[model samples]
Target: MANDDLIYKTATEISALFRKRKLSPVEYMAAVIARSEAAQKKINAFTFTHYDEAMDLAKQAEAKFMKRDGRVGVLEGLPIAVKDESWIAGKPTSYGSLTVGKGYVPDRTSPNNERILKAGAIVHARTATPEFSCASYTHSRLWGVTRNPWNRRYTPGGSSGGSGAALAAGMAPLATGSDIGGSIRIPAGASGVVGYKPPYGRNPDDPPFNLDPYCHTGPMARSIQDAILLQNVMCGPSPHDIASLRPKLRLPTEYKPIKGWKIAYSFDLGIYDVDAEVVANMKKALRVFKNLGATVEEVDLGWTRDAIDTGMRHLEHLFGTQLALTAKKHSKIMTTYARNFARKGAKSKASDFFKSMEGAVRMYDTFGPMLEKYDVFICPTNAAPAVKADFDENKDVVRINGKVSPLPKVLAWCMTTPFNTLSRCPVLAVPTGHASNDVPTSIQIIGRTYSDADVFRAGIAYETAIGGWYGSRKARPVL
Candidate 1:
């Protein structure tokens, strides 16, 4: 196979080739590492790398495959880019902040990292993120900016922006992403890749974030099968996390077709001011579901901006509060957005937090019943194509469909937070098409509470109908 083919091959394809002795793990790893280095010069996606060590691991995997050993794990020879936010023992996990990450190293690995390592996947690089993983676009004082591989002027979306960019640039076939509020899906949509936000507890997470129902650690890849491949390995109960669900759920590689399935869609989710290009792409994507024999209908969520406000309040109370504590000592060195987030969090009251909880209950009261009526819900993952690569949420103005919006209102353009408010629902983000600027747009496939398989069933069907993404040199990012 050509080097570009080796670099961009899906994890599923790479794994099969490794098993069949048609491709050497070392050869594929080398191509990917080279691609990563080249892409980094343009997209600034990786924070650190372990190329030599990764090469050594690839050799071991090749040896195992040659020996026809039964010891091979599901992801035996794949190269995965781990989000910098995840902890790996003895490695520097800079959450893209100098104040918190300078010279910091954890003695223990995060559950996500431990599981990925045990699955025999090689981690060749650590992708960048916003400070404390707090922003929607990836950029930081520590690692500079991570741009979209498709269009450098725009962001790849965040806080898993780097992972999405890496996958889109063919740096790696798969990567890991954590979502408290659309971190994985935003980047997946902007970068034209696939991302899955499993229902909370379907995948094990490190504590205290694990205890937060809105937080989820999942997979990002160039294809739906690749996302499912990594998710199956990352999920299941772990002794390390009490919140993990009992009796693991393993998804099948293939699902029964979506023929005759009922799919409900929302262009704006009732509050967001969606861009015309995004809506146009969403309409085209809906046609894919229709072509697959699924019935599509538009629904009124009856939701208001309160859904966005509630999710922000909850995050400020929890995620942002932690940032506030960190800023107590490191405020001088933090990014403006991070500091602003911390300040907002510090001002939140117990009453505010409780009200946010009550608001979530009200929001779910409607969403929960809607799921019962439809096989899955579909909406644009992001209301706009993307923010600027160096967008400052605190100072920059965001214009959606020609209407100007402010800092918090900027959240109004992302249709993801509402689902995070209904934290038990599973969401899968898949690419639709590119905007005029060449930045990609995507749609979300939402399932009923804990109905993980349903979203994947819809996603696989949609992906198949679209003939899959990033399949050729022309389909991938020019970088």
Candidate 2:
């Protein structure tokens, strides 16, 4: 491994270094602190960067690693940045929301981070997110907005924006992110990093199934291998999440090559107003898959507008009631747009909500059999090329094909969300190529239910073929 470990230095490389005693876990932890502090001032990627606690944990990991014990886990010395929404003990886990940041402290910690802690990794910092993770671009009244590392004038993509930016800026070795409607993958694309939105129940949730339909907590990293390493530590079923599968869970391995694998590419998955640069970059990247001997076809996934409506109504039943009480009391603090958006969802009747759920059930069932013939599905991870610095996700303004479009329609460019509806399928977001503006455009490669390793395997092939993400190490110096 190189001394300046900036590129796609996977967990495998780090592990080998640790095993050889070439790198101490504490040294990695120090790097995490310095890099996180540096990335924070430039990108606003973290809500809190824990220095003392991280080193304390790293020392323990160093001792454990030096013992030459076979029991040391795969992620023994790894440092991970967790999203603020997913709690870490004693940290200010404000979900980047005005209410929570004001003083909505919790007495308990998130079971997800707790599981990672038990696996021997350290929580180096807590990344930023949208207020309550409401939008696709990450901006919050509490922590302000996070800028992309490629260009500070643009957004890093949101909800999981901080996680994406932190990883992209080399703030931490890896980070945790929760996706509800493309939160993880969207930012992953914008920041030119790897994001995996696991099938629902893949990783146990702390609060269980709060807004279960589109919510998924998964791993995000700088490369396919790091993502797999973090996923290995965090994945497996748990009783905590009633939706989770049993403890025997593991990343499915595929020794098969990428040659001749059938990949279906849906430009919009039926309908979306996307940027020309994004589309062009994606199409160009498709040729790489073709060169790798994969049969890439522009196949439609046959999605109807009801997919969005169905997903939203599901949100209404879940978040509507929960946020209504909060909204009703603090409606003044909430954005007029956000309050109205949540309020509209809050008004859904039981009948409509049930019908939406039923329709989604039928939709997924109808969609499942079609995937039996294909190894994976592909699509752009976001609507536009990359959002501007002040881009308002709450607003309905979106330009597609030189015409103004609605936010819901263009945001539909995210072919990544519906798979989360499938519960056990795995979706890996890999940077395809940089847009005309130099920010990266990414595609989501989704595998069948519980086939996460297949997604990682495909990502590995793509990473090897395309080489690493460009300009990944250039960032403002925090010092």
Best by lDDT: 1
lDDT of 1 by residue, 1-479 (tens): 68887787789988999899999999999999988888899999999899999999999999999984467989997899999988999988888998966578889999888989999999999999999888889999999999999999999999999999999999999999999989999999999999999998999998889999999999999999998899999999999999999899999989999999999998988787888999999999888889889899999988887888899889999988999999999999999989998999899888989989999998988888987899999999998999899998666788998888543843645778888888889999999999999999999999999999999999888888878987878898897
**lDDT on C-alpha atoms for all candidate structures:** 0.90, 0.73
Mind giving the per-residue lDDT tens digits that candidate 2 earns over 1-479?
43246323555677777778888888777776776776678789888777898898889888887785567866777888889887665667787777766456566667678778888777778888877776767777778878888888878887798998887776776888888778889899888888998877777776745337467888898777777777776777665667776664666433456998988787776757677877887888789888989998876656777776776676666766667778978877775435755686678889877877776786666567757877887888876656665566456466666887643632444555566556567889988767666677788888887777777777888888877553333322122
lDDT of 1: 0.90
Give per-residue lDDT, candidate 1, residue 356.
Answer: 92
Candidate 2 lDDT at 224 equals 78
lDDT of 1 at 367: 87
